[model samples]
Target: MLIGVNYHYIRPWYDEPYPGIHGITPEVFEHQLKLLGRVGHFVGAAEIGEALAGVRPLPDRAFVVTLDDGLREQYEHAWPILRRLGVPAIFFVNTAAIAERRVLGVHKIHLVRAWQPPEKLLERLGQSGRSGNGGQMGALSDVSLIESIRRRAAAHYNYDDPETACLKYLLNFVLEPAVRDRLITECFEEMNPGAESEISQRLYMSGEELRILSDMGCLGSHGDDHLPLGLLTPVEVQREIERSVERIEAWTGRRPEALSYPYGSAEACAPPVSGIATDLGIRFAFTVERAGNPDLRAPLHLARCDCNDLPGGKAACWEADRLFEEIPRREWYLDEHVA
Candidate 1:
């Protein structure tokens, strides 16, 4: 079976994690990579499109490693490890974040979660961020407070769009855009005062850095702003994909052949999204659908697995992986994140 796996963050083992962001230690990631090396034929994401187009056939254990979001963490923490291993992977980027030079509301939420107490932040947003996850947060335990906030956010974070669910609901839908921006900016100021020009750059890879990765692996579009395309207007969706293709090509010279939906799961692919992608001549599309992609005909809506979910027992894990596409991914993400 051909499988796809992805990651979002990697951090040092002993460092305190920033809240609202999930990370695996470098030790864990390396272990997983080595495990994958032992079992699968590692390939880049763009290659899957070729297999799908019948240009080539995929090997039994063909797979790709993809990193969504052009985070600095990918460049700082994940890049060296990938480089050291001589692994071929894909770094999917959302270009509007660079074009606009502002932090996405979701990232801002993470930053605020790391900077302030959950209690205070919850109170700021008018929700009780406390959770009954059997943990108590004292005023002095910032880590505990962060966990509490995270638990609360997870309770409602249905998908990766990070808006209209938990903190996203309050920040993205409830408050006006300007209001949300001002509030998040104010919260950002509390942590970092007047040092705003490079916030997005600090958080994500620079064009030069991404271009370097392009030579090593491949670059693909996550979206223009990393927002869910299914939730956008047709024009908005087209623009998001088109602009990302343009910007990434501007950086790397070749246009992107693959795109993974911003928060795509199996249920997240809209008809218009596929329609637009076809119009753009995009070759492959990926979703966090947790399965093997053995079929070549259906390339635009391909499935991917989370590497962290792959271990525990190879026999049982392999058996269960096939069911991922059969199961609707929205409910899976909801149950996993909030249930």
Candidate 2:
């Protein structure tokens, strides 16, 4: 059986009480690596595939490391550390973000960080409305104002743009560049200091960086647009999958036979629509949902444990072992005939 851990960011000043905010801290990450080294063989996604195929011996304790979002922090922080530890990990990147060199759906996060009172930010966002343009701020019912801001922010940041229309309008009317930059950064830090610069640099992996990581046996596709599968039409899902595969293939000369679902779950992994992997000739696919190792029969719906969910950074190593052991017992019960 193969155990895997999913990671995104690694925080520096990880307070144990916080568990590094979202998940493990860089300190905890280091600790986890050390623990994993003692207990298991740290394999990459490809090696895990080979072992599951019975082409290689499954180590007494084998686990794979996988990361999503392809954040710059992964490049700036996790990559060097993983290299130093000599552990191979997979990073999944969305094609559009990298190609465009901008982050989608993050300016609000930045604005929230920069603005004074949360109320003020909300007011500015409310004034912006659904259009990216600043419109007339009539007497908006509270719900209307809130909804309008959300829609506009999603549109502005959810694609390939950085600055939201409200941000542009605010700058035009009030603040200078230095003050604006400072306010934005300050607000971001106030809201989430750990993610300030990291959020701003949420740019996707460049083609050159992708190649380098691929050459080093890291990097894979998260998807073309990073849209959640269940939310998209079947036709849209197919296009998302195909476009990602084509783009990766064009860059690497080798089609990526593996994929990670945007927000993977049983419903999202269901037949026909979810079977895009098998249809696209993908050999393996991963999900965010917690489950045991792949059943071999359902190679396309492999399970991965998120490291962020683990109690301590190293706790996942134990949890992974327990889950691996239970898979056989669960399979046996399922296969047993009932009286």
Candidate 3:
């Protein structure tokens, strides 16, 4: 079985501390990569197909690394480390955000920060019927309200068709760094920005950076505005899939055959999306679900382990490696007993 690692958020030492203690610092990331290189076969996405097809030898301790939300940090921080270690990974990006040059769902957080008296923002959220206090508000946080603002801003831009107006409303008003920082602490526990802003001059991977990463053996795709698939209408979901694939293909000049779902889990991997993957001829699809890799039965529903759980960096990498090691034994037991 092939083990996969999902990573996001790498912070610099000097930046304002993240709101919560969830993101991996650059130092920890370096240690993790080194550990993986030392103990396992860090393979590229391409190698997985070869191994699954029985045309190539799978490494004794094979693993793949993947990132979601093609953040500039991947290029600035993660890319250099991956290059030094000679590890191949995949970066799943939401095309709409990239095209708009703004962050998606997280904008609501920025909007809340920008608008004083957090109560007003909460009021807007309540009006939208998407926010409630925990159970009452239905998991809507100050962050969710910010995300709603971003969606509204995007819709306005689409209708107005003016870059300047989009910049004024979406990028300028909601994405200021001070606003982002405040929201991180006040709203959500996690400090990392979920999306980039077109307005702010913050760092993100440039087109050239993307090209270099692709050339260096990193695959790319759509995490689709980071929405849970179960919540969207069928047409909306299709649009998300098509738009993401189209953007990546246009940028990379290679149609991506692999996709990773946002907030993906076994329960979220319904037949509709799986059928979409099959129709698109995608070779692989991934989820955030924690399980052993499927044995060619459903390549589209590959499971992965989130690296965020590993606070020990290199030690954590080893822990992930250990989990992969358990797969075969568990499979053997299941086959022998259950079958």
Candidate 4:
């Protein structure tokens, strides 16, 4: 069986004015890696492919660490610790951030929220909705729509408060991409004038750093623009995947064989997204679906749990062995032929 743990925003501290970005400190990350080491053997992308191809047998309770969004902190903080501990990790990157030095809309929301309050953001979204006509953001004023958003927020972000979660869901998933981008960019620019280039440099790893990671065989594609694929048209999805693969290859001198879907949710990784990835020569993919892969029946739809759902996380079990006991297996694997 394969258990995957996903992480983002690993830093020394989260001293934002408010609770906008949530992640573990380097000390906590190291402790978790050590704890995970006790319960399962750490594997890498190559080993996973080998095991799936029947070239090598996987150890019992094998797990892999994946760092998404290719944040500089992963290289600066997490990579050194991983190197010291002999743990292998895959850093999945969004090419636009690394190549064009642009901040993604989702990250813009994070920075805006950290700078201001959720209520303030909701107000701005409402203003944008008014200007954009009655779109999804207009539902902010509808009691029923607000309630539905609250429920989804609770489901996706159980760690956040009701207000914060609702704000996040609306910004990240509900609003139209064009509207969200325009509104968020306006807000972000208001706070950091002419600083997008500066922020991008600090927020993400450079091509040289990514090349170093590629040399270590730890880099993967997280798509371009970081938009959820399922929400986009088929053509747009292909562009997102292909553009990322091409740019990453050009920058690093290696074509990425793995992908971690942007958002990694069912709505984001649905249908042709996986088939398109396969056609594009991606060997495997990951989703934020919380479960373990008992077999490689659906390599592209492999499930992953958040770091918080495993040992040494906020919602982790006290005993590492007991972790899998609570997580159900991917029952769909029974319906497909084992790879």
Best lDDT among the predictions, by candidate number:
4
After best superposition, candidate 4 residue 25: deviation in angstroms? Answer: 0.6
lDDT at position 2, candidate 1: 62
Model 4, span 46-145: residue lDDT tens:
8988977889887878889999998999999999999999999999999998788898888888888998988898887777777765376665778887
- Misplaced by over 4 Å in model 4 are 132-134, 331-339
Error of 1 at 69 (Å): 0.7
lDDT of each: 0.67, 0.59, 0.58, 0.87
Model 3 over residues 133-189: C-alpha lDDT tens digits?
Answer: 223233334687756755655653332333323333432334333332343334433
lDDT accuracy of residue 244 in candidate 1:
92
Q: What is the C-alpha RMSD of each candidate to the true structure, in Å?
A: 8.1, 10.2, 10.9, 2.2
Model 3 steric clash total: 9
Output the better candidate (1/4) by lDDT. Answer: 4
For model 2, what is the alpha-carbon lDDT of residue 250?
82
Query: What RMSD does model 4 have?
Result: 2.2
State candidate 3's TM-score. 0.68
Query: Looking at model 1, which ten-residue stretch has the lowest summed lDDT?
Result: 131-140
Q: Write the per-residue lDDT of candidate 2 for residues 1-339, one digit (tens) a residue.
A: 566678876657433321112434677777677765665678886786686578976565567788887666677678888999999898887776565544433333334533344356545545443343333333334676546655554543232223344443333222333334444545555666576345445545567777878777676778876655645677878898888878887887767767888655444444454466568867777765555563444566666766744424543434534545553211211222200
Window of ten residues with lowest summed lDDT in model 3: 330-339
| lDDT for position 185 in model 4 | 87
